[model samples]
Target chain A: MKSGTWRISGRETSSLPLFNTEVMGVAARRTRGRRFWSNLVNGPAARYLFILPTILFILIFLGYPLVQSIYISFTDASLLRPDVNHVGLKNYAQLLSDRLFWLSLRHSFQLTFTAVALQAILGLGLAVLLNQKVPGIQIFRNIALVTWVIPIAATVVLFSFAATPEYGLFNVLLKQIGLGDLQRYWFGNRDTAMWMIILMHVWRNAPFYALALLAAMQAIPQTLYEAAQVDGANAWTRFWVITFPYIRYTLGVMIVLHVIFTFNNFEFVFLSTGGGPVRATEVLPTYIFEQSWQYYRLGYAAAIGVAMMLILLTITLISVRLMERARRS
Target chain B: MTMRKIGYYSAVYILLILSFAFLLVPIIWVFLASLTEPRQITSGSLWPGLRSLTLDSYRRTLGSADVRIHLRNSFVIASMTTIATLLIATLAAYSTSRFARISGASITVVVLSQMFPYVLLMIPFYQLALQFNALDSYASIVFTHVVVALPFSFWMLKSYFDNVPRDLDEAALIDGCNYISLLYRVILPCAAPGLVVVAFFAFVSSWGEYMFASILSQSKQTATITVLLQGYISGRRIEWGLVSASTILSIAPTVILFALTQRWLVAGLMSGAVKE
Candidate 1:
């Protein structure tokens, strides 16, 4: 109580300049300004200020470019020309009839489905195998994950080297096994070109799925499995009843993420095949790039990009809806 | 055990072995090919004989000035991008973590970000760089990469920050700690492991990126390692030995980071994906 009274006395004495109004005017205003500034600095306003940089970054770098891209889709803006001519839906109309565009759209679906499906299946299998109480099981899982960590460029080059025409690893192995008939330019052949793209994607993404599903599998109670076995449920029955249901959400999450990734993925396809063997492996990403960068059809490429974005948006919504339904059911 | 039981165990082991080989052989082959002679590589032979193995590719690749410049550019750009991403993402994540209204708003942005492919963003970036006279500049590449890496980084960091207890944040604030100090002194140290994982993530993505670098990095001064590899492959004859050696160099940082932080990274991935 004595310290409090002393602090009050100190404040009252310090305010004696108030009686000498001329001397206190500037100092009083400065203190008022400082208090306001400190109030902002020490309040909830400061917390919201933290995201100001992020918001400004998005608005300037990402959002502005996106808005410009959408606008360019409606204009005949080519890098070859200095002026951007306003063309009303001409680019979009052209995309409707463009053969390569449709082929690419079709191939995009093909790759996304084939790769996602294969990854889900392969991942489930590997997760199940590794989930078994085998000694050194972690070694298998860890090595598999290495495929996912390496860069896309490295993976492409590694596979490309392995698939070299004459005596590459795949062909050489074929020769050693007395099946030289299978030896050919795997990527050059139209039939196998798309598969090669899918192979690289699956090789990279499947382990990710496996890891997710395995984590989910580990969270299930061991006693639940024991109870199921006591009830005469076999291994397959127990898995379908317990393991499958438990990991379904993780599987769903992975599927949604991977679908977006595979559909928009350019590096793997671009590096591995360059949409080669006469457009057999051409997808929307490479097609968009070729039209814009190679042909300088900036306006046209923007239109295609707009279209691709809508397709991705639609697919994402549908999958998310389906995932929600799966969770409910 | 019955014969059927023995068969089941044997089959499981066989499948495991085959799957592991499929996944691991390519990574192992990169190291082997890096040591093999260029001529042996040209013959489509993965095995260059035990005696033919040498450090010749490493010596040549390291000796090349071109490789050195690219390695430097790649490291600098990736490091810059990582630092920038962590700074922006951490502050945004921490602030947004404190408020429901703002985080809800930012989550929409993050999800919506998934819609814009790099190809869509490519033209504007090209033109923007040119307009700003930042073309062929490290700042341009680093800026583009930071933007690219931001959304995922923000999401991951936000999740990690959420995992940090809020009681501590309140206690610090109650003890006369300012908002910024609370984040730096309290929250960040708690989330240090997550920070390392996110750093590895940001670095790896920047190191691997190609499309923008291919266009923006037009000169020797700014080309990243991926661009260097692209140049080697686009030529008539790819020097496999050089490419392999370059690949080793490109992935070396990630290999070391992963070797040290594999456990932390795995946990981060699991928690990020499966949490909700």
Candidate 2:
């Protein structure tokens, strides 16, 4: 109570200066009068005018839709119906019971793991290769990012076309190479569809990761390597002790972003398989489409949407925290 | 020891060569098939048989009733989106960096919006677009694309602008230059490299976008090249020749654009993670 009373006294004392300045200080009043209206009309107002459009766009397009999806998660809504029937947790309950949902969830995890793991490993390996100042190496580096440049939808269609069992270029090449018997259906069957999609995803994304990591790697100084070499360290030792540690944080961030991108991707899978021959390759995005658009069960799809958001949120938080902590140290 | 080094070099070369071939094969196959007559694909002869080469698929895909209109629509939408996004993002990022601080909540919202699965936005955005009476209009496509592409451009340009020395602005102010003239004459020219990267990325993204274009547009007048490509390939009886032809054509402009601006792309893409 004493401290509170003292703070009130301090504020009252500070306010007395303004009143005295207003009454007795003509110079101060003139300066304040000149700046006040202009500041009000120009400075703060202009700043807000600059900021408002972007904020409004984000809110209406991104924010509103996210909330709507959450609302839909609670009710029994479908694409065919205009009105949603409130069913509370029933849709989520149904999602838990649905076998296809579980399977797609598993497939989504599988896709993310395989794609990210291979992309990271191969990307790092390739980055290391190109980091050497080999002759004509710049051309190879130029070609490396081409896969990333290709559209995902185009890549999917091309790969799907290339993997066709009968007239596929892959099958033809295999047959010519004496593996005719093993030329199986790449996207026509359940067993191989997801695997093929995973391969395509890796092929498309690995170079992108390599480029990102390569850039990170180049930022490391040559002095460290020279010092290591002077200390009689071999290539392997120098790499492990220097290069690996240097790019580790960047790699972690890239991996998390890759995970999120791969997890949310729709065009590649949708174009290649449309979640079937038998719903074998359906990840969460395609699964949501199947539920909401195909089967017209919007609420159940929204539940899946919520689950996806939670999973992605957990992954992102963990990744950012882990990498950021390491960065600070 | 010298022999071992040569062998290692050869092995590496072989691996790289094989990987390059693997990467280019599908793309080459598409090109070859585009030249092959539709009948020959079913005949199962490879290499276009050296005798099956024709421009029938290209003629068909490009000369279709709706192809030209769709291409025009795509060009208009993507071009508009690119120009508008660049303007808004450049201004917004400059203001956010220089004039005022964007709150944590705003940052969070931006990040979350970017992370949002396009699938989740499909229905709601569509509903909103229709309610606003923007359905099947170029404005709808352009606006939706601008929203999607703004964050990237803003973030890219902001990071680049932040690295710029503020002394330039202060010096301009001392010289009695206003903010507008300073930005145009000084800041923008200094940020040319970043602007190129932002513009290229925005254009490429808007060019290649499929999901929104597919959902939001139904008629040829508003449909994009990707949607048109889908139309050619949707039936059970896939028109492999025509589909391949159109796909190749669709990518041609972008491929050329990237090839020309590869230096800037590498610099920009690398800059996000690479701070040298």
Clashes counted in candidate 2 amount to: 0
Clash count per candidate: 0, 0
TM-score, cand. 2 vs. native: 0.89
Model 2, residue A101: what's the lDDT? 83
Give TM-score values for chain A, per-prediction.
0.87, 0.85
Q: After TM-score superposition, what is the CA distance of residue A58 in candidate 2 from its true location, in Å?
A: 0.3
TM-score of predicted structure 1 = 0.92
Q: How close to the true structure is residue B192 of candidate 1, measured as C-alpha lDDT? A: 91
lDDT of 1 by residue, A1-329 (tens): 23213111112223222222233234334676755655565544776788888999999888897888899999999889899899999999999999999999999999999999999999999999888876787777665677777778878877887777775678888888889899987888899989988999999989999988988999999999999989999998999999999999899889888888899998988887789888899999999889887989889998988898899889888988888898998
TM-score of chain A of 1: 0.87
